[model samples]
Target: MNKVLCFDLDGTLINDKNEIIGGEGTIHALKKLQNIGYKLVVSTGRLEHDIYYINNRYDLKLNYAISQNGAVINKNKELNAKLLDKDEALNIYEYLKTTDLRVELNTVSNRYWHTDRDPDFPKEYYDSSNIVHDFRNVIEYQPAVLFLVIGESDKIKVVQEHINSNYNKVKAIRTSDSSLEILSEGISKGNTVVELFPNSEIISIGDSENDFSMFELSKKSYYVGKGSCNKATYNFSSIYEALKQIIKGEENGQ
Candidate 1:
């Protein structure tokens, strides 16, 4: 059976500025784990290209990339995806239109935003790579997920409750104070990981609520940094420290 180590990208592996926290040490530890026959997986809410970008930029050489929470997965070179029902997506679009929230549709490679543009978000998301579409027209893409950016922290819970209560076809998870993730019901990081590697002994490392699913499936779960995840088996300061502990666990036959 295979041994897998899945990591959540943002706060777990990289910092706020997108820099690898442990730098060379983190890379070395990952390489060592792979050398010992462990499969490395990056389980994140990021897009596919961003996964490749991290591997290329950091030399992480991950064996699998679970993108968009769990809507898409790249196992080695093969792609597997589960898209939102277009009608359900449109239903959400209509509901979100009633609010002042900044909305965007996320495909495996691109993010489509309304052409009217809300200045609530940073210029980074409105970059040249992502598409600009009029949400009033159609659900332009078969999105893997929808990002609803509610800039106000107070309204975040209210919006999440509204979506979860009204939508049976989709579920909304509060990924951050300003953001909520909407994906098809029953899809999650844990389900996807177990589906793909059913016989493997898994370990999860993350720092947020979305990572909770992964944590639930792990043989050992590590919650890094300060993000809220009470389900983790342990907590660590940095990825390097966590990786080292994982190595130590193996050495001690844990």
Candidate 2:
């Protein structure tokens, strides 16, 4: 059986500025591991297109990519998606419309955002490509994986808590201080990875609350930066360092 290395995107693969400063070193390590027969997988909360966008823009490559926090998987050029319930999505959408939060609905192919974009929402994180004034009219026609609410930390918490308290079919989690993400209950990166590779050894690397579930399922895990992740097996300042260490361990027969 093969060993799979799964890593998060935002804080792990790229820096806070969205640049891969350690590009050459990380790419070398990844290529060496691939040559040694390791299956490299990029697991992220980003949508499929965004994953490819980063890969192309940075010249980084991986054998497989898991997107939408595990709701969508692209393996061997095939797409497998686990979409949220349409009615459940609509219910959440209806409730979110009542708030001033910047809501983004992520489908397998495209992302639709609320027209009432909050001015405070970080410009770097907001994508203005697709904006829908109202999702109710087309909610039933599209397949969605999750919904994202972006705002002040306090407002994000309030929406997350409300959804957790009222919604049975979906669950909400704080992915970051300014963002709250909602996905179907029981759907997570860890769960999806385990299901995809039942016989392989799993190694996870990430830096936030959303990566905790993936860490829990990993045989060895590394937490990047100072973010909280009690489940990680080790801590590193950057993904490049983690990859170097992983390569060293593999060469030493660990």
Candidate 3:
């Protein structure tokens, strides 16, 4: 039986800065582990486009990806997507609209924002070429697989509290301290991993509170030392060092 290694993109595999500044060794180490039959997958709150940006920029080849915090699962190809049902998605959307909050909808291939900003909105955080749409009328369409709301910490908390209080139909996850993300209930990184590799032993690596679900489901969990979260099996100073250790262990049949 083969072992599965799932990595969280932003902090565990790369870093908060998103430069891949010190993960080359880690990538190489994972690749070496893959060569020895350890399956490597990425589970992240980001969308496919975001993952593709990192892959293309760094010239990486991943086996599978669980995106939108687990609302989507795929194997690199856009055509191989598994998304939430339209009715379930719409229900969450309708409930969210009743609050004093803005939402961003994400499909398997595109992301739509309910703002006046152009579809080609600029992202100051990372170098991304993600397709953005000005979905002024979101209700016109069914709910998307992923929905995001960004604002101040207090506002986001209020919104989260409201959602938790009023809506029990969706899973609301806060990937970042300032952002709230909603998805279909029971849909998460752990669920996706089980769906794809039911029999494989699972290990997860991540660095945020949003990764709690994955950590809870994993047999072993690792966290990047500098990330926001504190629960982990091991804390590493850098991705490179972590990968080297993982690769060496896997290579030695440990």
Candidate 4:
């Protein structure tokens, strides 16, 4: 049977600065994996447009791309999207408007958010994509993924609970103490992978709480750093070491 390796992109693959950390030797490792006939998939919370921008900005490549926490899927450069209803989208906007958090709304075609004054959010992303400045100006019933960055932990928790209780159609994950990511229900990296490759053996790697759903669904899941809360089967200090081990036969397609 064929095997698949799913990777989480943000905290796991790239840091906030958008550099591929610990990847100086990754291409060789990845080539070896490809030679051994393993399929590679890029799983990320970023929507399609940001993924495309980042791929080009960083010179990245992938066989398949899962974006928006699996709300969108791309294979062979063809894209498919599952959108959030306008009503639900409005609910999300209203729920988040109370906080000082910088919210970024990402669709398959464009991303919407406040201007670059907020230093916490990546201005580079805002500069590269089509951005809708006002909610009234947003297109009708467009599919979007929202990224909320900055807020006190307790406040963010309350916000998440409110989203869960009031907006059952949407789900939020606290990717970090100050960041909460909202995605359409029934869409997650793990669920998407299962749907796409129902019969394949899977291996996964990640470094944050946003990755927990995918970790829970993998045959073997490895945490990328210490102090990770998710119950990974093993822990690796970096992605490079994990890939190198696979290349050196430390772990085969078991």
Candidate 5:
């Protein structure tokens, strides 16, 4: 039986500063796992465009990807599934305008932002020329796969509280201490993985609070040692070290 390994980017595969500290070794480890026939997938809160950056930068031939916190899944750049309901999506957009928070909306093919002056703006995302819209004016648009909120941790928490209090149509998740994400109520990394790989034994690895959902859905879980994730799971000082264990099947217990 072949095992499936799903990795969360950002802190798990890369470091806190978004640097590939382990370099080619990490990629090599994944390649070795692929050679051994273990299916590998990247499950992340990042947009598909962001995923493309890693893919092109690393020259990796990844076949599967779950983006926008599992709101969308794809294989070979072809859509496999999406989790947004039009009504729920519309309600979220309406509710967001009541808040002063900056929000970024991600569709299957594009990303749009309500504000360009946001200090926490993702520079890389802006370079892609994703649509920019003013929150108050845009209406009747389809529900995006994911919504990203970047700000101070305290401010993000307040926004999350507001959403929890006012909205039941969607779910809000915090991937990092300073970011909040909104998605359809049932959309999650676990749900998407189950849908995509129904029968495979799943192993998930991540390094932050956002990864909790994936951890809940996986048969085995691991956390990179550098982040806010609990110390209970297997911890590695570097990606190469973690990859070495994974390729050897030695991290299975984690």
Candidate 6:
């Protein structure tokens, strides 16, 4: 099997509005990468429903996707083949309720959230997720990822400390100054790629702090936009530009 070129969905593959800015040529870039013996993998924090929804709407034609920040992996056209344990998810959910943060809990089939007292939440979130009215059934639902949005850096540290002290089998990473993502230990988009393709040369592409893990693990990395990520081999303004650079290198017999 060929090595993979992993892509982060939002900001890397498309805009916040779920649009790829370069138009149809971007699709051609993906196909060209495939023609050049690379398998394209869409890696994102989105649920399966939203990933499929965006791909169909945008015609991205994704073959593989690592969803929920790598809490789940879909390969060979199968969906959600790997998932986190439900009891561990309940542990996260129950403890987070005591803290002052908004949480988005995800499973393969559904998404539940708690946005209490969070007035700054985007309107799209209001329409996208189900409010967690009943948590009695959370464990039975088998969550794949737990995303918490904290208002301050202190709260982010608090959660990080809590995970370190109590749930050493899980991990808490700061996706942003105000956002923390929780998942099983070693469950990251980069780790997933390493686990699935242990000997492959992986090229990871992303644009944010959430993407740092992949950059660290990739054979080479193309970071989109200007930000700090450990071990990014190159930087590009957009996916189209990155693809063109790689294709051009191939044409020169590099």
Which candidate number would show the highest TM-score if scored against the true structure? 2
Ranking by TM-score: 2, 1, 4, 6, 5, 3
lDDT of 2 by residue, 55-164 (tens): 77766667788998888999889999887889888988989989998888888887787574556432333352477788776568877788988889999988988999
- CA displacement after TM-score superposition, residue 124 of candidate 3 (Å): 9.6
Give per-model TM-scores.
0.90, 0.91, 0.80, 0.87, 0.83, 0.84
Tell me the TM-score of model 3: 0.80
What global local distance difference test value does model 1 have?
A: 0.79
Ten residues in sequence with the least summed lDDT for candidate 5: 135-144
Give the alpha carbon lDDT tens digit for every residue of 187-242 in model 1.
Answer: 88999999989999999898888888989998999888574457998888877899
Q: Lowest-lDDT window of 10 residues in candidate 2?
A: 120-129
lDDT of 6 by residue, 112-226 (tens): 6654435544223224466777554865745455555556888888988887688756778876667787777878888887887788888888887778788998877888856
Error of 6 at 170 (Å): 0.9
Per-residue CA lDDT of candidate 3, range 40-100, in tens?
A: 8888877767776777777667788777777777754554444555666666667667767
How accurate locally is residue 60 in candidate 1, as Cα lDDT from 0 to 100? 75
Off by over 4 Å in 2: 116-128
Runs with alpha carbons beyond 4 Å of true place in candidate 1:
115-128, 131-133, 136-144
Give stretches of model 5 more than 4 Å off: 15-19, 81-91, 117-122, 131-133, 136-139, 225-232, 250-254
**Candidate closer to the true structure by TM-score (higher is better), 2 or 5:** 2
Q: Is candidate 3 or candidate 4 better by lDDT?
A: 4
Ranking by lDDT: 2, 1, 6, 4, 5, 3
Each prediction's RMSD over C-alphas, in Å, is 2.7, 2.5, 4.0, 2.6, 3.1, 3.0
Clashes of 5: 0
Put down candidate 4 lDDT per residue, 86-201, tens digits, no spaces.
77777678757777766777767566766654565544453545545665446355555554555688888887888878877778887777777776787777898888889988
How accurate locally, in lDDT, is each candidate? 0.79, 0.81, 0.68, 0.72, 0.71, 0.73
Over the stretch 92-162, how does candidate 5's per-residue lDDT look in tens digits? 77777676767777666666775564554434532543555663333246445667787788988988887
